[model samples]
Target: MSDARPAREPGRRRLVLWRHGQTSWNVERRFQGKTDIPLDETGVAQAERAARLLAGLRPTALLASPLRRAADTAQALADITGLPVRYDRDLIERDGGAWEGLTSREIRERYPAEHAAWQPPGGETSAQVAKRVGSALERALDELAPTGQLVVASHGAALRLGMSHILGLPEETWERLGGLSNCCWSVITEMRDGGWRLAEHNAGTLPEPVLSDDRPDAGT
Candidate 1:
């Protein structure tokens, strides 16, 4: 297997959407939406390891959610790369409202209809999150240099929704993008046509080139 990172085309920028390390709530499978939870011991270790690898990418800028779990995770990379972490409120996780502290099973039992729709009563809707988080990402990109790399440390749901928004994927098709595991990341690269392409998702290691039918040499 090649250990190379994804190939970057000229005039293209890159964004690494990284999820925060795990917390106690993550282990318990509790809804931690917008909660200010800190990283657990294991989470701290995970962040440190991931940071070492990310630092090697030499990111140009680091941005993160204001929540402690995400801030701390970003700090790990900051410590290694000497990059200042800029916190953005819009990058915060989805607000779970009445389902904030409930386990998945509990939410299913208590609010079956809402759970089926994956909406939390009184919480921000998926559209709200996608727009908010997506706008934040765009603002950050505006500040980046052409061909620069940005690493955004955020929550799982927030990153996924924001990515879908950036790629112009409709809400109904957002589910086609899978969730990122704790401390994993997804990479998006700018296209020559001014759009974005997902290079990698839910990945721990650096990305390698993808082989697909779309490639010119596919049948070779």
Candidate 2:
């Protein structure tokens, strides 16, 4: 398929938060944290396929976590779009600390209370992650044109938490935002009020406008 820029409304910008492809830890259900595990063979293929689809969206900027898995995934798109991929430390995954390399069941068995609270001992908290990643995203946006489309290759928890931070979702309701599957992505559009609206989540295909009662002109 021909790769061409997609049409966008004037004065609006789009951010695509894309999760990296699968790794060995992903298949084993082990915590990756900042482990820097490279992508598995399957992951390489996944990134290639995803890159093809995202290339059609014609992203203007690319950013990614410096972690190997995320960086490699971003490279796939960069190779296609010829956009330089910028690495941001703030985009790294939540530091799992003592929980790193442990499976979910193992974590619960070893640290019952911490696991119950979803807090890894000596690791970054969800709030901290949200703030760090969110700030990075805002800074990147500041450098982008109003109509530019930016694609960020990052980890699942980081992207989810960051998106929640930007969208101003309360911590209690953060879980309401589901995790993205490997190589999937979510899109957020800038609203006229300088806020953001989630247009799509955990999507593998290009976004289409959805009819909703919440539309700005719905009551007219």
Model 2 lDDT per residue over 127-220, tens place = 9999999989988887878899999999988898899998999988887777777888999999987789999988985322221101112111
Off by over 4 Å in 2: 1-10, 205-220
All candidates' lDDT scores?
Answer: 0.83, 0.84
Best-matching candidate per lDDT: 2
lDDT value, residue 43 of candidate 2:
84
Each candidate structure's TM-score, on Cα atoms with residue i matched to residue i, is 0.88, 0.88
Q: Cα deviation of 97 in candidate 2 (Å)?
A: 0.7
Q: How big is the positional error of residue 77 in model 2, measured in Å on the Cα after superposition?
A: 0.3
